[model samples]
Target: MRIMMLKGFLVAALLLGTSLSHAKPLVLSSLKPLTLIAQEIAGTAADVDTLLPESASHHDYPLKVSDYSRLQKADLFVWIGPELESFLQKPVANLPATKILTAYDLPGLFWPDEASVSDDHHHAKDPHLWLDARNAVTVARAITEKLIKLDAPNTDLYRKNLQVFASKMHELDNRLLAQMKPASGVGFAVYHEGFAHFVSHYGLRQLDYITFTPEQKPGAKHMQQLRERLSKDGSCLFLEPYNNLQATRDLAQELHLRIGTLDALGTQSTKTYSQLLEQMATDFLTCLTNVRH
Candidate 1:
């Protein structure tokens, strides 16, 4: 009886040890895209949360008192740096260097405005780097690295998740490469110059944009200039969320172009980064083929 009780106590102790594993680390991301990346690495090993809503523009997002508290409670914070979220510069500066990760800090990230894309295809430095799967993989590795350091108990899980994320990203890249090949050299315009990373990554031709900033409406003369230039070569005009849908419809009708909306902020249903990019490619192909989604 004593020997049986000893074995039972040992088993119970082991079970208790397994049950009382490391606490789940909280990774707070500035955007949904980053949050998705973090989620891939964190999985069930950590809790992932997004700091910004999909509806708000990162350029001028108003931070609330609650936002500060969230930032404080997080074990790690990830963002795209001042280039994208200028509003975060001051607040994130308060965090320790070890706790905060940004895109500018990562190497091998493809910035479209740089030598990554053609001059004709590229416009300016695009802050939306997560549009590229390769860049997203890079970010996933960084997040895993930090997670492993912060939550050492789940290092294996984090590392394995990173591998899976990278593999999926490669699969996504290959699929997108083939899918976009059909639409390559096809001229499409956007509401703003934000899709350069996705456009250049997939080799689609972006002819022109309606505005530099989404809120900055071009004057009549400027509109006329775009109209004259694009009326000849532009085949499709893509609008994004928050764009004036009626105006885009009018312009598309005037230009005799197909219409589609490319969402930089992934939809309510978008759970993964791969899903977001795949949806973008599908939307692009649909627009090119004149099959609106």
Candidate 2:
């Protein structure tokens, strides 16, 4: 009877251990940039996942029932705040306060040049804060702080990973600043206003843009006005990989100006968050300089 009891106890203990090991850490992100930064701080110890796909426009991203389900499972949720992804507002508010972190709340980041027009939930602030390497540093630190608090047992590991992430981010910021020094205020325009964060950090100027949101394409009248603006000062149109390529191309052709594609949201191969910033800086600088000459 003693042997049989011991065997039963051992079996139960083994099963419980397996169950605990299989339980995953809950992490949810609303954007690709946050997803990448969370993964770095999470350090293989958490299940970091993103809600947005590569091609979805944040301006009109449709929220689904599954998104709410995903949020329910998250121990912590990271989002760009209501300015960028207000679609998540209702659901996120329904979540317990302890479970969500908004990157917009972070300090030491610069707002868009036109504050009155920024954060309007319409044609307003550029939601692409990750494009600014310095902002990414703030985001990574926030992620690390949250992860350490939630997963104290692994605090040391999170700290170490965050340090590595921040170092790489700083390096990228320096690179971007150096590369854009010559192009500052050269005045390029974009099909959309997403480049505000990028240009704001580098001290570059955007002569004009269609709008902050990609939901509404400019009408013919607005297009003519933009053309007139560009005609007076030969400026290149910055395009995004996921935007209406043909329209932008046509605009470029019509005005006889150069056009370049920017990957505001990094790719699967972007791998790390820092690489995304480097890519944007390099691409923008190259595009602007080529057009100038």
Candidate 3:
């Protein structure tokens, strides 16, 4: 009788342990870069995942059934909001306001020049706020504060992580600024205008963008105008991994322009926010400064 009773208690204990292990708060970010930021703050206290795959386009993502299910179960949902991921607005609307975080809503976001805003896209704000490290610090603090409230037991850990993140970002900010200093006057073009935050942060010069969104093809007249403009003064054309590479390549070749690749999503970097920023800086320097004239 005693042996049988001990066996039952052990099985119950095992089951309880499994249940507890699965109870970690799940944080779902709309994009990989935001996922990295959430993971850095959440650490082992919560489970963090990105809703969109690395290959998916953030500008025009179609929601799947599984995405809805995931959002329904999420303890927190982080996204760039409707300006970037309009498809998520309806699904996220169903979630409690406390459970949803919009990156663009964070304070100290960089807005593009009024004159530069595209009428075609009709976007009031630049959704790529994460590219700026200062903005990223704001995002990390917001995530940490929310996670601390959700997981009180892990408050100390979350605060500690936030401090570490802030310190590292401060150091990285100076380092990246120095690294980008030489490339300040270098003229570069992009497939999309998503790099405004990055360029404005480091004072780099961007010639122009082929399109506001990658999916939109430049009309023949626009392409001819771009070719003419680029032929006279363009230094290099930077393309994103998800952009229409063939079109970019054709445009680059037509103008005899140097080509460089920038991955704003941090898809190619290790699963860390700092590494993503470093990788972007490296990509910019390597392509913009290293390419022979």
Flag regions of model 3 displaced more than 4 Å.
1-22, 112-123, 291-293
Task: Write model 2 residue lDDT over 193-270, tens digit each, in one string.
Answer: 777788777887677776556777777776776677777775578887777558768878887777876777786678
Better of 2 and 3 by TM-score: 3
* Residue 121 of model 2, lDDT score: 40
Tens digits of lDDT, candidate 3, 148-210: 878898999999998998899899999999989888877778888788888877887777788
- Give the top-scoring candidate (lDDT): 1
**TM-score for predicted model 3 compared with the true structure:** 0.89
Per-residue lDDT tens digits for candidate 1, residues 1-293, read 99999999999999988866656888999989899889999989899999997788766689999999999988899999997788899999998888899976699988664443323433457888899999999999999989989888888999999999999999989988998887886777788767778988887877777776576775677677668766877788898877765876898998899888888878889998888998998899998866644
Give Cα-based local distance difference scores for all models: 0.84, 0.77, 0.83
Query: Lowest-lDDT window of 10 residues in candidate 3?
Result: 114-123
Please give the range of 10 consecutive residues that has the lowest summed lDDT in model 2: 115-124
- Candidate 3: the clashing residue pairs are none
Candidates sorted on TM-score, descending: 3, 1, 2
Model 1 poorest 10 in a row by lDDT:
113-122
RMSD of 3: 3.3
